[model samples]
Target: MSQFALLGKRRFAPFFLTQALGAFNDNAFRYALIGMATFRLGMSSQALSTYNNIALALFIAPFFLFSASAGQLAERMEKARLIRIVKAMEVAVMALASVAFMLASPGMLLAVLFLMGLQSTLFGPIKYSILPQTLHPSELVGGNGLVETGTSLSILLGSVAGNALMAVPHLGPQLASAAVIGVALAGYLASRAIPPSPATAPDLRFEWNPFVETWRVLGFTTRNRTVFNAILGISWFWFYGATLTVQLPLYTRNYLGGDASVLTLALALFSIGIGVGSLLCERLSGGKVEPGLVPLGAAGMTVFGIDLYFVRPHEALLREQNWWSMLSGAGGWHIAIDLVLIGMVSGFYIVPLFALVQERAERSQLSRIIAGTNIINSLFMVLAAAFGIVLLGVGLSVPQLFLTVAVMNAAVAVYIFTLVPEFPLRFFGWLLVNTLYRIRREGIDRIPEHGPALLVCNHVAFTDPLIVMACVRRPVRFVMYYRIYRLPLLRPLFRMAGAIPIAGAKEDPELLQQAYDAIDAALEAGEVVCLYPEGGLTADGEIAPFKPGISRVLERRPVPVVPMALRGLWGSVFSRRDNFLRRARLPRRFRARIELVVGAPVAPEGVDAAALEARVRELRGAEA
Candidate 1:
């Protein structure tokens, strides 16, 4: 089913609405203040700028102060009730906002903004933590995509509405105030319908000192090196996004010579691109959390961002252009497409990382992890603002600054990928499968999404493990024959993947023992391991007799064993069909149609070598 189908489900829709509305109100209120200060009060430009800076600082302060406490609150209570309470706080803040708008009290509005930020800080942890509870393992990427799409659009619409509404005459403030307050109430009503999400860490102690708890939660988030690195990636994205987006107004006005309507068009295109890209993730990943998309996305962001600088009009146009005027001009369309593609790739960049955090973080401390993420995000935003100031203050043009950040994105991607080699390795596998084969999966969901399980498959080609790893979503440690594992081209990838190389007792007794030890250790650590019990690839296009090595591994660790088969690969170039002299021939089955059929997991006790072999044969029958 499509991720859009989730919008109709009671389990997700209400919370989706509540979160989107909260986002809408927050942006609407903040932008309404900017509009009011800019147009209504007739303040000096310097004074308006100072007020804007103060407002931004006030809103961000709560995240630094209360995120850890908020995380604790989210963990200590049921998510539905906590969300409702946070919504109630928003309503109160909006009520104060209504009075402040009527009285035109800058101090009152600033205080209300601070309160809004506090509410958001409290809601932050629950926002993501509730997702894993409400969504199926297969639906995580789709769910996250939908939420991101809604948020990006909401923020865009809310800003437009707030600015338009507040820029009017005497009754403008009244309309903006009423609009935001109503949205808050509606958000509260929506929160009431959210299904209960039980607290993940109800029994855990929560520290009262914000600083100490902040340190502890951050520690928890970093314990898993991959998850922490993913968080860092996420934070960097915020920095990249904030830096790029904050420049849009100046970029549109000074460089493109566009009016407000044109800026709106630019924003719309970018946001819509994000929505499209976010929705596309489920289809691209086959309902799995595919981190491989990260490198692809990071590449697109840099490529398009750099292209944006080159395509921009060299000399700024003196007169402002409207939407139609720009579209009629050559320069306008290129810039628009660049923004949209950049936005789309950004969606590609973030959804997987968010899904990864949800998938990998310990269930009990998920809320704390989310809180840690929010803290880091806020910090990055602050840094991004400073980054922009430093660059622009140095007399660089907006496009030049954009060029710098785009190149920096590549550097950052390299650093992160170096830290987590799985990213690039998985990217290669995912890229290969998508580009080289039309793959159809059957019963692939039968394998568990989490916990320890042993997978046994017919070894078809050298790429068997890579194909399976790409499809299974979670990382799988493959056990391969020592010879194949030692192959020059494949060895580095295998070692990075933590694949275990095994040999028959006669071939190498010590190596065989070592492989068994590694397999047992992985199972005990709750990781998935795949074994090709055939010992080696078939010399002919047929299944090899199952070895008894699997039985010994089962005897030691006794985990659920899933039987799977690879079909339509026997005649491919990667198979024995290519003799050594003919190996350089063009792929016999280039872009071959392939299928992976998975059977229900077998309980270890009843699983002997022969029975599992029969299951795999049955799955592969009449196909390979």
Candidate 2:
């Protein structure tokens, strides 16, 4: 289903609105404060800069100081109740903010900023952790997409509203004050409608010491290798975005200038780009949490970021006109496209990682894990600000800063992908399968979202494993013929996938036993292990007699065996129609129509090779 449809469901809509309103109020209050200080207060440049820095720091400090405790509190209470409570806190903060605005006191407004940050920090953990509890595993990606879309757009609108409202002549402060409190009240109302979500961890031991518990929270987060790295990926995204956006006003005024309207235009393009890209995730991933899109997004961000340096006007357009003049000027479209693409691809890069963390982290510890991520995110954003300030202070131009970040993104992406090779492996599989086939899946969700499972399928082509990997969201370890596993073009992906290389028992008994050992171990660890019970790719577009490898795998592991079939791949380029010589195959369809028909899993207790083969043949039907 389209992610937009989620906005209509009570399961998602209320929580979405509450979160969106909170984001809206946040940027609205912050930007409006900036407008008031810069325009109304007659503060000097130095005082204004100091105030902005202090405000940013005040906002970030609570995530470090209170996020872990907030996460624990969320775990202790029912989630909907906690969210409503948080929203109530927001209302109180905004009410105080209204008083601060009326007083026109920077000191009081700064205190309100810290309190707002505290409220946001309290909401952050539940924001991410609640999703997996509320959403189906299949809906995870689509749900994340909607949340991200709502967030980016809200931020843009809030920023615009804050600035516009604060610029009003006599009632700027009153307008800003009224808007924030109204938004807070609205958010509280929305939160009240959220369905009750039972706490995942009840009767858990409490930790009250912030410093010690903070260390423990972060330490526990590192225990899951993939989840920790995904968290890092998210932090890196915040760092990249913070650094880029913080420089935009100066970038607009100095580099792409026509007027301040150009800054708003640039911001709109980037923000809308994120919204567009976030909404696209549901369709692109086919409702699965697919991280294969990360590398693609990272690559796009790097490419366009570099292109941005070259496409900008060497000198600013110092005209009296606004964004309209810039939009119709030379290379304007190039600049707009670069920013939007950066935002769009960043949307692709971030949504999957967030879903991956929520989907993979333990439910009981999920809130704490999210809290750890928030802490890391806070640090990264601070570092981003520092990084930008240092580099720009030293004399780097804004465009040069963009280039440096783009290059650093390439480096960081490689490091992360190396740490978790599943990302690139899935990338190759997803890219290859999608490019070569128009695929359909039936009963794919029956493959199971968790725990040990043995998947037995009829291998129709060399691309069989890739097909299954792309369709199934969870990682699958395959036991395949050693030669096939060693395919020159696909070897890296296979190695990354942990495909166990097997030889015939007669040819190499040691290797056969080794493959069995690996499969057994993987299943014991609650991983899905897939192997073609037919032993090899079909030579004549027909199912071969099932081999005994299935028996050996189940003898030790005794896991559920999921039967799957690959249809319409027998005549494809990767099929054995020409005996493994790719160029020699005739009638090899590119972008071929294909289907993966999955049967309900058979209990390991009574499953057998012949029965599985029969089931697979039935599922395949007459497609081959």
Candidate 3:
């Protein structure tokens, strides 16, 4: 079953609702506070700005201050009890907010903000740690995506409700306060539904000192390079988002020249985009954590951001009109379209990074690693604020600031991609294979986990190797003819993938020797090396005589051979049987089901090339 389908089952549904409600209430209360400051209290522009800035500082500061200790607490205690206590704290904080709104006291509002921040800080550790307890490893990404999408949607809805309710004049604060309290209460009830998540480190000592705990948690991250990098990627995303979201109010008022509706539109667009991207992650990742999408997302963010700078909202006439007026205006559609794409791609950018972090991190220290990530996020957010100030000082307008952020995104993406070429290389290969063919696979479990292994498959199409590479998580070195390996368009891909090029003895003895040496090295390093036993694609859609090259490799390295087959590509242009233009017109759409069937591995000593070839042909379900 798909990961998301597991979440719908009773074990996960309640916990999902609780977390979603907590996010909802947090935004609802914050927006309610903003609404009161703007209208009910007759606050000055300076005061409103100061209030918002202080609120941001107050909330984020707690994450850095308390996350380390809180993470350890989650690891040490029963997560269920801690979540309940946090929910209770939310109740009390919202009650205080009720009194603050009623009395119009700024002090009480700030206190409520700090308390809410503390509540979330306590909730953060348990929030992530609880998932693994209830979910299978495969379900983690989908569950995380659902939570992310739900949180974004809730914030969007909560902001609207808070603003709408707070506009009710006399009863605004009362109604808003009541609604927030009710949401918190509902969250507590949902917490009851979450199955008990046992602590991973039950006997672990709980440290109260944040500084000591911070380093301890960070220590756990040093062992895993991928996990550490994934955390950094997530932290970078926070910086990107905080830079944009925190500036929207100013951007809306000054650049867009619209009222509240402009802010609403921008936020709604961004959130909706994130939701779209998050949901689509499953399909894009093919049920595995793929970080290649990170660079893709970062690239889009930069390109669109730079474009947004030259967009000139005022030129589009979006600056002077209401939401409805803007929609009706000419060229407004262009700006709207751009914003939507930016938001959607940003979503695409973030979801996989989170999944990658979770998948790679050690289960025992996952919460601590997450805590370290939160600390880094807090630091980046502060940096974002500082960066924005510098940009503002240099005479950049809010729209121009957006442009600057976009360009910076490109630089950041390049730096990360360069540091980890695997991500980009895999993404490039996956893009080609997925776009080119409607591929399928069965019994892929027969593939070996490690060591020198040979993959023997019926030669089918030009793109078959790429298809196999995409489906298999581990990287493989394919042995192919020197000419085919050096094909104009395919050469760069082969180079990145480390494909070994060979030649027949009559063709080039030196190249053949290099190919053998490379294949041996790959086997010694415990990598999968794939080869076509027939030495070329099938011309008449039938199996050819078995060649001894497969046996020669086995005689040298003696690794397990996984027999695989590809079907449904015989008549296509990519297949050897058809001309390019003729093959391109066939194997129409969703009807294509090309299977990669892996039969049981053959023991090396007894295996012969002809026997292996016949076995592979049988696995392919081919009549010939």
Residue-wise C-alpha lDDT for candidate 3, range 172-263, written one tens digit per residue: 88898899989988988888877777887888888878898888877876667656776777778888887777666666555566556666
What is the overall TM-score of model 3 with all chains considered together? 0.84
Q: Clashes per prediction?
A: 0, 0, 1
Question: Which is the leading candidate under TM-score?
Answer: 2
TM-score of each: 0.93, 0.96, 0.84
Model 2 worst lDDT window (10 residues): 45-54
Pairs clashing in candidate 2?
none
lDDT of 1 at 467: 87
**How big is the positional error of residue 446 in model 3, measured in Å on the Cα after superposition?**
6.2
Q: Higher lDDT: candidate 2 or 3?
A: 2
**Regions of candidate 1 where Cα sits further than 4 Å from its true position:** 36-55, 99-110, 313-315, 578-584
How good is model 1 by TM-score? 0.93
lDDT of 2 by residue, 366-432 (tens): 9999999999998887787778767866877878988999999999999999999989988888899
lDDT of 1 by residue, 197-234 (tens): 88887887879999999999889889998899999999
**RMSD of each candidate relative to the true structure:** 2.5, 2.0, 4.1
Model 1 global lDDT (CA atoms, 0 to 1)? 0.86
